[model samples]
Target: MNETMRPVLGVSVAIWRGGRVLLVRRGREPFKDHWSLPGGRVEWGESLQDAVRREAAEETGLSLHTPHLVDTLDMIGAGEPPASHFVIVVFTADATGEPVAGDDAAEIGWFEPEAIAALPTTPDLARIVALSQRS
Candidate 1:
């Protein structure tokens, strides 16, 4: 029997305040060295909401509030090896504590709307942020 491959389903939390968005420098594979939103994979049997909260806490060392589903992205492979196809669900959230990069994040920073254009963000992520700013 041939085994079918499955796309990794993950969630991301886009924490925004005023005109700035929180971004993280990835520490691992799949986009290492690029600026991206903070989040992680959903565990088996875990609710989406719970997964978002858990990933936020684990990666950023902060507690988020009132997250709302914002957008969904289908990421196709762009680079080499183990080429991933991901279905990423994005959530907008509010958090209190200052962000400190942990786990898979190498660094954390907040980017203003204008600065967002200059960041090395993924194409899908750029679209999400654009729509979010308008909404």
Candidate 2:
């Protein structure tokens, strides 16, 4: 099997404040330039919560706490043989400090749930936003 076919664990954090969620414009492939949550592939030996915190901080420059697991998404690339497959664990957390783009993020901003529909985003981002709202 090709290494790219192997499923990897990833984490995404929906850092919320004042009825809005933080979103980033991805600066890398697999969703380049698309609006998405702050997250990345989990490193070996890292706990889920730790990965979430690390990713959130790395991508958005904000501190997060008390992450509540919101959903798990199977992010499968669409192509003849598929480009990537990631099992993404999504969480909602309380965030501190203003967000600034860093790492794989091109831009970062807070967005209301209704505003999500106006942006180009990763697959299932709307659903993820809804799930975050319920949590």
Candidate 3:
């Protein structure tokens, strides 16, 4: 079977501090109003590092530095209305500035470890967060 579908590549920044991770409420389609990590599609001709920095800055008004690539995830929705699958590259980063909500995010907030379970997150996102916390 020949399939013409190509998975979209997404880059997300997992900014952690004081046992909490930054979460953003998306205000657009394909998970609209859902709280998730900060990120978006990677553009052509841009390096992965550059994509990370650009996505981070565009979504959250913060400059990321020393963003080490951590993990790659293949995400697929499980409900009756399945969502498009995406290949997400997550990076653990250290930044020197405060975060302000921007871009597709309607609002942004920090969530403690205990609060993560209550937030609406994809399975891949939950797995990545767990793996990142262990490292």
Candidate 4:
């Protein structure tokens, strides 16, 4: 089957500190240039937990662990056969190092929840941040 014909498993981490959340500007599409959590599609043979940690490190250069579940989002395009479908798992984790954009991140910034609401972001990104705060 073609890649876009099936749902892709993906992961993201919400790193919150001092009442702010880390966000990355997406370097690629689906929602390019939009501010989003640091994550990407999971690889074969990798566990979800490992995917979370790997994605965080790859995208932000920050090592994190023991992620708490924050939310899961189904990003599906409306089409005859769906342009794309991604079931993304979200987690909350703590970090020790400053984030530097890499992988699919064009840039990085820390934003308070209120500040996040003003930026152009992926759908439900603001809501996701709110959820992370309660996790």
Best by TM-score: 2
What is the lDDT, from 0 to 100, of the residue 70 in candidate 2?
93
Candidate 2 Cα outliers beyond 4 Å, as residue runs: 1-4
Residue range 94-128, candidate 2, lDDT tens digits = 98888899999999999999999999999999899
Write candidate 4's Cα lDDT for 1-135 as tens digits.
465467899999999888899999999998999999999999999998899999999999999968999889999877877778899999999987988999989999999889987899988898888888944
lDDT of each: 0.82, 0.91, 0.81, 0.90
RMSD of each: 2.4, 1.6, 2.4, 2.0
Of 2 and 4, the candidate ranking higher by lDDT: 2
Best by lDDT: 2
Output the lDDT of residue 132, model 4: 89
Q: TM-score for model 3?
A: 0.87
Which residue pairs in candidate 4 have backbone atoms (N, alpha carbon, C) closer than 3 angstroms, thus clashing? none
Candidate 1 on 1-135: residue-level lDDT in tens? 124757788999888877788888889888887888898888999888999899988888889897889889888786554367788889988888988999999999888767767777765777787665624
Model 3 Cα displacement at 56 (Å)?
0.5
Off by over 4 Å in 1: 78-82
**What TM-score, to 2 decimals, does candidate 2 have?**
0.94
- Model 2 residue 119 CA deviation (Å) reads 0.8
Task: Report the lDDT of model 1 for residue 27.
Answer: 90
Worst 10 residues of 1 by lDDT: 76-85
All candidates in order of lDDT, best leading: 2, 4, 1, 3
**Candidate 3 segments exceeding 4 Å error:** 1-3, 77-83
